[model samples]
Target: MTSDLFDLTGKVAIVTGSSRGIGFAMAQALAEHGAKVVISSRKEDACTEAAKQICDAGGEAIGIPCNIVENDDLDNLVQKTKDAFGKVDILVCNAGISPFFGPATELPDDKFDLIMRANVRANIHLAKLVIPEMKERKDGVIIIISSVAVKKGNNTTAYSISKAAVDQLVRNLAVENSPDNIRVNAIAPGLIKTHFSRVLWENEEALNKRLSKVPMRRIGEPEDIAGVAVMLASKAGNWITGQTFFVDGGDTIDI
Candidate 1:
């Protein structure tokens, strides 16, 4: 009875890039808490496997492959999820990319464009597409998985810039839709043990260096971020909107 506040018994959620990593963990968590989850990513095989894992665990889930950069794919994702679940109560924009590594001055135009497209433009596209339905229902939640890289300095210049843009996007969307009962927010995770962040946590020297600054003395895991996603999407976070959660293990504070 005490846990009922977080119950998502009748909610449906769409999590992009949910085949693995933080996205997969959040999808699984949401499903476990009673939301019908739509697991999507660029790879059909991976999406299928992720959905199976959740189902095998007795959670409601389905796989829908999508490449977020493509508008057609985003359209299909929304349509498929709505067909399968009737309505989307939650949207997790977790798909992101950082295709280049260099100083900001040395960054190439193509790489910058790619980063913006994947991290910023794609989110805007998905939100706009989903907003109409959310508006109709007079209820919705959008969680954009931004990064702590935007707060502290990261070697990936374009990536950080893209994330910063996402933060602003959250603010603008939330303000615009708050009156309609839609809540928009961002989660900034730091050095989580995901494939996307392997370069920072896999190497011994790099791992130790990162850990040294974190007050927790350990790197974050996907589940750490997943818990917050559940809150922000469920009744537990009903009053919260236009906020960015820093799930970093003190990385942002130490910096």
Candidate 2:
């Protein structure tokens, strides 16, 4: 029975932005652990392909395209997941955007608002949609993918600010939902070798500069964050709540 602690049999999970990168990895990991997974992103083809990959690997999965910035899409995503799988036991708010990579002061008002809406507000909306069912069931897990950028001031200020808000959102939600046995947490990952992060990691000069701050001396892979999500979603993390786990290869701790 002890071995069953990480098992997620009969659980249903929805992972946003799961077409690729960290979101896809988390969805795959959850599915491998016996949870039925919904692979969702803005692109239907990408979502379908990602879900098919999981299914090909013998995991139960479905593709549901969702644009997280849209309230209607978020509602439909939750409703469709429930319609297909019965109930959502796990929610991974991994979809986010950082359209502007400039100084905070120079960030356009529109871009700043977009970053906040997509990176911060979207997660809050999704959580609101799923928490009621979680309360009714008296069990649920919400994992938002934050960023290590929040730890330092950089050109990516708008994005960093958005993630900071997300970190607080996790804490606040955890405090509010702890009484209902619901857990809300976040994962703040450092520079990873994902398409979304290619700009940071692909340039040898910039990559080396960033690596210097990471004690691990290397970039992370999507799988690096997936394991943590598994732990947080399963019984292994039942006692843990309202925390942000940094999977940045020691980048956050280094000077």
Q: After superposition, how far is residue 135 of candidate 1 from its true place, in Å?
A: 1.2
| lDDT at position 110, candidate 1 | 92
Q: Estimate, for each residue in 15-48, the C-alpha lDDT of model 2 and write its tens digit.
A: 9999999999999999999999999999999999
RMSD of each: 1.1, 0.9
lDDT of each: 0.92, 0.94
Per-residue lDDT of candidate 1, residues 54-122 (tens digit)? 999999999999999898999999999989998889999999999898788899999999889999999
Report the Cα lDDT for candidate 2.
Answer: 0.94
Model 1 clashing-pair count: 0
Error of 1 at 74 (Å): 0.4
